[model samples]
Target: MAGSHGGSLKSWLAVIVILAGFTVGGVALCFGPNWPLVWAGAGIIAVGGVIALLVDIFSDVIVDAPRVLASEKVDRKG
Candidate 1:
């Protein structure tokens, strides 16, 4: 679905990876403040960030032109 208002599969995958990292970190903290696991989670998040950059996720973004309403039109009568 090119030009659709949604991210590509790769972008979605990266987002999922980042979310998983947050979950892992949260779980580790709730358990016993497991430093090792926490670090691992951070690493996972970093990897996801790298993936996002590599894929140029922002390149897929589409910005619509600004709309001009009829009521906002200026009168040129002098």
Candidate 2:
């Protein structure tokens, strides 16, 4: 059961969110108090977004069409 830390990931996520909020909150509380770490958060979010965009773009290569059998249809009049 050493590696079976069930729900630990959820707990860690909760802690990270809380800490992030507090960090921005503290920045606002000590600084102008209006735009507390907003820029920093936006920048971090943008970085992740850019990576996702690049990955998605790179994976979207042109796909080939499926082959159809010759007997499927025929133009007898032609």
Candidate 3:
């Protein structure tokens, strides 16, 4: 998967994590014995958010480096 299209697998996994977090969090918030379940859901969501951010950052860096380097080369040539 990683070799097929760069980091697509990680991105898809992150999305799955985010969706699961939202689903669990919403259900826990709606029906729970105590506040701990809600907090735990929030924590899951937070971790998903972090994973999402990291994936976005990594993808951006991977996508941008070649362009940046190419531009630098053009600048040097021009």
Candidate 4:
């Protein structure tokens, strides 16, 4: 239950890798027009995607049942 809402560590790592790639690409654009670094960033993002697939991150996701609020329950009773 502690980690029910959060995904696995591996999935988190994959997301971090992808975010790092975005940061790299952003830095490249901010400083001069560094096409090579942009490409490198794209590669990093691709690697992250591959890692996510390899770890089967989708399988770790789950749909939780919708909670019934107390107010809603009272309204239904009336």
Q: Write the per-residue lDDT of candidate 3 for residues 11-67, one digit (tens) a residue.
A: 777777877877777887778644777677677878878988987835632232323
How many clashing pairs per prediction, in order? 0, 0, 0, 0
Candidates' TM-scores?
0.73, 0.35, 0.54, 0.80
lDDT of 2 at 49: 54
Clash pairs, candidate 2, are none
In TM-score terms, candidate 4 sits at: 0.80
For model 2, the run of ten residues with the poorest summed lDDT? 1-10
lDDT of 2: 0.53
TM for candidate 2 is 0.35
Clashes of 3: 0
Q: Give candidate 3's TM-score.
A: 0.54
Candidate 1 similarity to native, TM-score: 0.73
Segments in model 2 whose C-alpha atoms lie over 4 Å from true places: 1-7, 35-78
Q: Write the per-residue lDDT of candidate 2 for residues 1-78, one digit (tens) a residue.
A: 133423344344444554565666567667775663766655554554554454453443444556676776656995
lDDT per residue as tens, model 1, 1-78: 654568689988888999999999899999999989999999999999999999898886655566676777677998
Best by TM-score: 4
Residue 34, candidate 4: Cα error in Å is 0.9
| Candidate 4 backbone collisions, by pair | none
Residue pairs with clashing backbones, model 3: none
For model 1, give the 10-residue run with minimal summed lDDT. 60-69
